[model samples]
Target: MQLFTGLALGSVFVLLAVGLSLIFGLLTVVNFAHGAFYMLGAYAGVFFIGYLGNFWLTLAVVPFAVGAVGLGVERWLVRPLYGRGIDYPLMLTFGLAYILVEVVRILFGAEGMPFDAPDALMGAVNIGVGYFPAYRLFVIAATAVLVIAIWLFLEKTSYGLVIRAGARDSEIVRVLGIDISQVWLLVFGLGTAVAGLAGVLSAPMRSVFPDMGTTVLVEAFVVTVVGGMGSLAGAVVAGLLVGIVVSMTSLFAPAMAEVSMFALMALVLLVRPQGLFGKKGLMG
Candidate 1:
């Protein structure tokens, strides 16, 4: 049961980490506002659920809404900082994150909001060891499908080819007459959209609050570091590893749950600084 719980939590990390990795890989930007986008998605999900009365519709629509916001941010804010060194964009995103969180707090107040799982997902399922929340299993399955779809889109489509090539050499792609700027916008939007989707999926598992994204942001960073920065495969593997470690530790030593991930990160850095799937020299 504990292991299952860890996997479910790790699945959420996978969604967020992959989005971060993709944006870094393609746009060369460290999006500190990614978690803020996630929080917004959760709030959007709440609104959609209240208005539409359908969980599935909320899942499908909230991501695009957040993605649209990301598109505008990338076009207006991030685009200007293209050649002005990395610090500029990093600081911009960091400040944007704070602004987003504060705005949400002002709009919704500091108290966490309650969101219940759909009636269809409210019960527990017996899986030999014990009964577990069916909603968690649903999360695991849904995330798996989404991840697989993303992998296919990145592997089999012409757009994916362009994205891969652009990631490798945007200048060369531009020389080939591709509008690399548009690609950058799309990639940023896609990354934030994924983050939003993760937020919506995670809403029922915990209270929704303006500051909820902070801890998840920190954990996603650890996952990125452990999995190797800008490595999608690394993020997936490291997310599960970190999730299981934290969950198991909580059973034996609850106080060490958070520390264990950092300890593992430190150990991994000492032994294999490049991370589990990271390539040498690709710091981003």
Candidate 2:
């Protein structure tokens, strides 16, 4: 049962960390606003769920909505900082995160909002070993499907080829007459869209609040780092590993559950430094 829960938690991390990896791999921007976009997704889910009264529609619409916002953000804010060193965009996003949190507080109040799981997924089922929430199973299965879709999009499509090539050498791609700028915008939007999807999926499992993104952002960063910066496969592997470690540790020593992940990260860094699948020269 705990293992199942861990897998569910890992699914959320995979969703969040993959986006972070994608954005960093191509855009070269460590978007601190990712968590804020996640929060926006949750709040959007709340609004849409009430307005549309359909969880499925909310799930489909929220990602594109937040992704569109990401497009605007990339164009208006982050794009200007290109060629200005990574520090500028990093600092800008850090501030943008705070501003977004404050804006949410103003609109939704500081209180935590309750978001119940959809009626269809409200119960638990026996998975041979023990009972687990149906929604969690859905989370795991849904994440797997989304990850596969993303992989196919990147591996089998022309746009994906451009993105892969751009991540390797933007100058060379641009020299080939490709519009690297548009690709960057699309990558940013896609990354944030994934984050938004994660946020919506997580809403029913936790309280929806302005500061909700803070802790998850840290965890996602840890997943990104532990999996190797800018490595999509690394994010998927590390997210699941971290999720299981955190979950299992909680079963024995609750006080150390959070610390266990950091310890694992420290160990990995001390050994590989570049992470499990990361290449040399990838990390600063």
Q: Which one is best on lDDT?
A: 2
lDDT of 2: 0.92
Question: In candidate 1, what are the lDDT values of residues 64-133, reduced to their tens digit?
Answer: 9999999999999999999787788889999999999999888888898887889999999999999999
Which ten-residue region of model 2 has the weakest summed lDDT? 275-284
> What lDDT score is found at residue 194 in candidate 1?
94
List candidate 2 stretches off by more than 4 Å: none
TM-score for each prediction? Answer: 0.98, 0.98
Q: Write the per-residue lDDT of candidate 2 for residues 1-284, one digit (tens) a residue.
A: 89888899999999999999999977778999989999989988888888999999999999998899899999999999998988899999999999989998998899989888889998998899988999999999999999999999999999999999998899999999999999999999999999999999999997699898999999999999999988999999999999999999999999999999999999999999998877778644
